[model samples]
Target: MKESSSFGNLWQAPTARRLAHATSQTSPADSHALGRLIGAAWVVVAYAARGVLRGYLGDSMQSGGGVPFWRCAFGVGMQLGVLPALLAALCASKGGGSPLFPTPRRLERWNEAWLRTPSGVWEWAFGYVFGLFFTFDLLLVPMKTNVLAHHVVCLAFHGWVFFSPQRPGLQLVIAGEAVLEFGTGGSNLSMLLPGSDAVRAFFVLAMSASNTYGAVLTVRWLRLQRGRWVWLTLLPTILGILALRQLHVVNEVYKRAHSPAPP
Candidate 1:
């Protein structure tokens, strides 16, 4: 008790107490309810905005009866929009260590210092991703099982951090995800405009590089935890699945980029 209070005093975080006694004092039920409400709200707003944009863009935006193209556009917009902030946070956290190999202290500060804010970049990004993916998963395009699974896993981990009062490795998960999705916008654009070989090439390079970095970071973080729990092992397994899917996307993009164009 004394140690926790002093720690809280050191950081002066308002939610620190709640974080310390998460299972008891912090009402996860309320957090879950509010999170769902916020996610649903974001989905509603995004769809309305998409509708407005589709109407304004006219036939230029139409593809597969206007579903797939806009879905990609929403993804591209969300991924690129939140990326700058996420990258800035990561760079700030990486300052004290080898940029490629983050040290334990640096990783701790990334979560304790920068990500301590209750409502900021992480929350906003989560809401956007949850809403955008849910909108697509349920309404816009339900047939894409791979995409659906990706969303499910992405949200599962993120949702844990968002709802749980005590977030042990918040920054690592969010930063890794942000980095992994860095090239996804280009991938979406490639799908929307298959003729744009440059975009497809960018997706291939970005996914390859970003996913590689994300995987390494995840491994380092898991090692830092010293095999804390068996469940945490799921991180690498899920990441491998996602990485393979992304690699498949990259391969397809490469093949299409090199293949002959229709006459």
Candidate 2:
């Protein structure tokens, strides 16, 4: 009994008591922080999965009686993800490095941007929505120029997969895409969104301009991680396309509610 009392007194000493107090006081802050971290992670996962499924099945460009292009879109998307993964695995098997975790030399400057990477929610959302819509857009244009225009723009979007949507690069891409579309008559989607051609053009241009200025920056911080971390960097870049079309859906519904009866 006496030994237990001495030990308790030792813990009650000023230094030990302060340490204990600090540890006890940290619990609420730590739990709150952990909760926030989990919430953000959940939101990101939802966005990525949303992007993939929507890319596979969502439709954007069709107006009336258009072919259900999503069926074909699903096939194309499967090819995009599956073919690359399989090829990487096959190459890794032959070379003796795991496909997922590539060698340091193979990935250059991957770790340099880890702190600034996004969770790839917007990018995937952009791709899936664009693919679903553009597939229909391609079908709408009977002329060779329009078809070629759509093809080239979509190809360029795919290329952005390698370039992180670090503000400067993403801004340029959006401006470039809008210009290419307007020049190529791919501005066809401009008309479908509850407005006249002039209004549509204005809206498209405005949205593109806004995105160049507005989309949230992907790099929340500057972190140095391993090179395999580059793959994570590539993701936000790839998935980080404009979410204008998706956001427009909400805007349209809101307009419809307010002006449900247009004479």
Candidate 3:
């Protein structure tokens, strides 16, 4: 009986302390409720804005030679609308429950091991050298040019992945698009002017990257937390952006393809 009591105390004491610590660290339930309310409100506003833009500008803006109206609108919705909504949802969902944005445990372990590996050091050195070349290209070249902009953005996003709180998995998708764009020579602005191969590749890569990442992040966030309402508000905005950007790329490609070849 004494041995049984000792064993029970040994395990139960730590469990009790952990529970007490968790309760002390946790935010008030009312605060979480208020956060949800605010998040929902932001989603409503985003939805309304999307409707207005689609209804008023989507059709008429198709006449312009630049990016399609719907695509531009969708970008606005995702960057401005959806991002905020996600942030709000995250705030609402924060507490002692299992973290929605829990750090990837295996990734942490891998990173520790990677740091100790010679190959990892070599890879890091290579990345730094390549990064310097890329940075030089950005600084000296006209990034406003269509080709450069695509590449620069890709590089920038890659850099962002290493430091940002964002998930590496998400960054991998974005970086993969950059790889695809690089392969296609999609960064030439002159091509965009004449709708060249580079231009088509740029648009396709950029639009596809954005759409894919936005959807992936949104879905991941929703699955980890009770935020389907927020995702519902965002999915359309992402799809709209993808469609518009795709159309712009196609139109440009068609125009260039049909134009008279150089004499």
Candidate 4:
């Protein structure tokens, strides 16, 4: 009887040890998934709040009396609020692991390197082009308020996504914004004036460049895990650019619809 009890205990001990090991391995993965969900939820909420504040401030700006300053203030606020969050998320996602926010050390390193690279020059060029297009929207607002609003929204969202860690999400948002504007009679060329084609081309090129950077990084990380190819990261940018072109065509149609009839 004693021998039988000892044998049973011996058999159950290994099973218990295996169960403990399995649980230990899974806990971090579960925690990581939870963290990502929480982070995404926070982002959605933050954006929603930003939209409401933007509308309110825009109304104030339209009323004159130093209202334009408020618009600039809002722009600065958005940079401060969203950019840091994005950087945090990126840092958190390092180490081939899920992060709740950007790692401080990683962000510092990126900032240092980014400041030193020629890529910084291209980024500045894109920023300037975007700013010029934005100023043009202010002049055209009286002719097509909806189109103006669309451009403002697009520019704001693009800035958020460009600086954020979730580049794919930003690409999708920009593509969707393009579609909305195109549907409403906004023309990329008209918005950017003489350099419209060049502006659009630069955005297209930037999209590809950013996607390539993301894909290469993802591939390197996956290789370390001995995982299969994650092709969607590379494919989405192509689809996004196609969507942008389609949006441009739709915007042209809208413009024609609203134009004065032949005398």
Q: How does residue 179 of candidate 2 score in lDDT?
A: 31
TM-score of 3: 0.32
Kindly list the per-residue Cα lDDT of model 1 for residues 139-228, writing each as its tens digit: 655335666666677667666655666455655566677767776766766667766767877877877777778877677656544345
Model 4 weakest lDDT span, ten residues long: 93-102
Residue 104's lDDT within candidate 1 is: 62
Best by TM-score: 1
Reference-based lDDT, residue 258, model 3: 90
List of clashing residue pairs for candidate 2: 55-128, 115-223, 116-219, 123-239, 123-240, 123-241, 124-239
Instruction: Estimate, for each residue in 1-263, the C-alpha lDDT of model 3 and write its tens digit.
Output: 11122322332445444543443343444433443454455445545665676576563332333333543454444433443333222222221111113244532443343334312221222233334435544553222344355546557745653334423333223223333323223322323233456555655565556555545544543343334653575356445544555566566567767989878
Higher-ranked by TM-score: 1 or 3 = 1
Local distance difference test, candidate 1: 0.56
lDDT of 2 at 159: 47
Segments in model 2 whose C-alpha atoms lie over 4 Å from true places: 1-118, 139-144, 160-263
Score each candidate by Cα lDDT.
0.56, 0.37, 0.41, 0.37
lDDT of candidate model 2 versus the reference: 0.37
- Across 1-263, the per-residue lDDT of candidate 4 in tens digits comes to 11123322332345444533443343434634543454455445545654665565443333211223334333333333433233323222222211112233433444454334312222322333333435433652232454465556556645654554423322123223322322222222233232355544543444334444434433332332221333444235434544555555555446556877768
- Model 4: runs farther than 4 Å from truth? 1-85, 88-202, 227-263
Candidate whose lDDT is highest: 1
Clashing pairs in 3: 147-187, 147-188
TM-score attained by model 4: 0.25
